[model samples]
Target: MTKRRIFMAGAMSGLLLPSIHAQTGTNTRIRNLRVLCGFPPGGATDAVSRRVSDKLQGSYADVSLVDNRPGAAGRIAIDELKRSKPDGSTMLLTPAAVITLFPHIYEGINYKTDDFTPTSTACQVQFGFGVGPGVPSSVTDINSYLRWAKANSGAASYGSPATGSLPHILGVLLANQSRVALNHIPYKGSAPGMSDLLGGQVPAFSGLLGDWLPHIKTGKARLLATSGKERSALTPNVPTFAELGFKDLVMSEWYGFFLPKGATKETANAAADAIAKAVRQKDVIDAFAQLGLEASASTPTELGIRMKEEFRLWETTVQKLGIKIEI
Candidate 1:
């Protein structure tokens, strides 16, 4: 009848269960967790979501799923996340731009930065400016490329994942700063833009580095520069925009996790712990590297700070660029 004996009896039976999830320090169990993704399957965003979902399967929920609702340039998934409950059962994994940059560019987005709770970031990827056979082989670096673009104004164009994406913004910055007349060709996704780049339909492409890796290895594409403070590890041979005297163009996109706005701090911390653990694993890091992404984690507070900082930065940049989406 002693307390220790009674506790031992409960532990021997199933009465003292659910404490097993205490390894994450939170006792909440999400029976059917759905990680909403705005991109389709087989894309970078979906891959990140699935990788984190794998690690969260047993620890955070009995089953973890990635719900792909790709449409309206990743707005569909965000809409779904807005409608989801705050019980920690629904989570969203998306690029930081969708939350930070979209609001400034899109005319009628229903969600705002405050609509979701920042949980943690899964990975970050740098954008690359590359050219395929469309450009003259002599155009090797950014300076030469600018010269060529300036001379061949008719053929001077760059394709990005979308009109309002970070890559698009970077392209616009490059064109304006360099005083060139480069046109923007926005594709629905990186794949199609990459396809056009490889086909010589587009002389230049600005997108995630992963989209250019395959062609780069095959000698079909050449990376002129990347959008990062330092050179990207994947393409160290290529200089960064900052190195090329584009100090204002240093940027990278991070994919972050989120919950409904009303989720409590406990739930947010639990999800962040699981995501941080998931992204730090050796396999996850290697996988992200193959995808041209750097696997890293951040606290809820850190993620929130990053979101606010990037949101304000984008607001100013977008307004300055005067770029807006019709739909």
Candidate 2:
């Protein structure tokens, strides 16, 4: 049988396809493909996954779907993905947080870095620090914000989607570097924290730029600085944290594709090529750019290296901050 046929059968049966001993001399035609994500339907992860999935569907003459399996800060979805068949048909599209941060913060996670093989990275989502308009800090830059917060008597309050998340670690890192005290308030997700920020219940929040862009434009919130090293093309006037004197504050949240571990190299490469082609389309690039996310693609090896680096970074940060959970 052809490699594609073998992969499809293995996907349906939840079994691994043995390595092809010789070249098939024919390209594999993908049939049904599922890309799993670990966030709610309307969140950033879901949005990007759907965008990529739509483009792939149009490019490939095959069935493609983006599945949402949000829970446990993405551990639930990761667990399910790990259990999936090691076939190209079943894959995952998840944020770096799920692989790099979640495993470090939470206990009893169902999967680890070894559970999957990298496919290709899709895009980089920029994060920013935003505050409600009511704050009188007059902090248009990161340095000034730190100065103003340190001068204040009480700990400055900030919000994040969850404890030990990228934003949370960034907040702590910023506080440590600036010698300022920040009171971190954790929320279940970005929606609730954003709600509190708009309602004047919280002074500031750190999250995806798209999540707070509307509020910033409406005068309900003011963006202080972004974590991305360079200013975003969509909001070039907004300075990066490095530009404002916080040199170590640069970071971007990445999203990428993964297949269940043990998939044949040829199957993984085919899937990655399909995804890279989909992401390269002008329509897909335009859609992601509109959300302040830059479109980029990486080989499986490159993604694997990135995951390892991010894992090390998160482990160090979590240990330093004493961030932990009871599972």
Candidate 3:
């Protein structure tokens, strides 16, 4: 039941930006760059931004900083981003859900889909529903969790990063599809949510796989299901929602970089190339792979097309899922 959409154009359109550097063949236009992150320092999105910033030092002489501006489920940072100068010095690197899902759910957002230029998609992350000591050990996977929810009235509640977030919406979809009621507990961010899970304050928690994978590996929390179509390479034994016959529950999470509106094509291309080169490095890929995030970089055009497609896809999916917030 996964919603399928086809992207017609090829992803790679070789741009001359890589070679169009100074005749000296040095990338010397070193301006201090700021990579804006909407989430706090501990989440997957922030982690990816820091990694990219670290690796980018090799591509340019600029001093890069990963700035976290967390609030309103990432609206604050994005609003700031939309208002910044159109120069390529400042960019937003955060989860695509903030771009694709927020406009539909949150009212009075200052930015629109066209407000920022999609630069590159850094990588993909999937969600996980992790259970802690508050839950009975008999409920192993999402299927059994649903069955248990039928028997246990209010005990079927789950915690997510925040309200109206992908995890929150996915929790609602799970309740609807499974024909059971699942309450939601929204935290300020994933770190707090995971902390509550580890402390057994919530019966279950939904967060990116990276947020819960280490706990799952250390036998502290049980990852009942992932939101990917296929099993994660880091935890192949764990079943995905699609693997459990809930195909419509699948939605891929991507961390994307976007420049301020009106950034020149040359600037955009330079930024994209630097990021793509940084992510493709062996150490970065290996580190990301441990968290089940593959190092996937896309051209600016490809990211733009993807943003449009995702915006459209989410419009349909949110309506179908009947997810609307009064904000």
**Best prediction by TM-score:** 1
- lDDT by residue (80-106, candidate 1, tens digit) is 778777878888999999999988887
Residue range 244-313, candidate 2, lDDT tens digits: 8889889888899998889887877777788899889898888887676788898888998999899898
Model 3 whole-model lDDT (C-alpha atoms): 0.78
Report the Cα lDDT for residue 310, model 2: 90
Candidate 1, TM-score vs. the true structure? 0.91
lDDT of 2: 0.77
**Of models 2 and 3, which has the larger TM-score?**
2
Q: What is the Å distance of residue 10 in model 3 from its true position?
A: 39
- Candidates in order have lDDT scores of 0.85, 0.77, 0.78
Winner by lDDT: 1
Worst 10 residues of 2 by lDDT: 1-10
Error of 3 at 312 (Å): 1.4
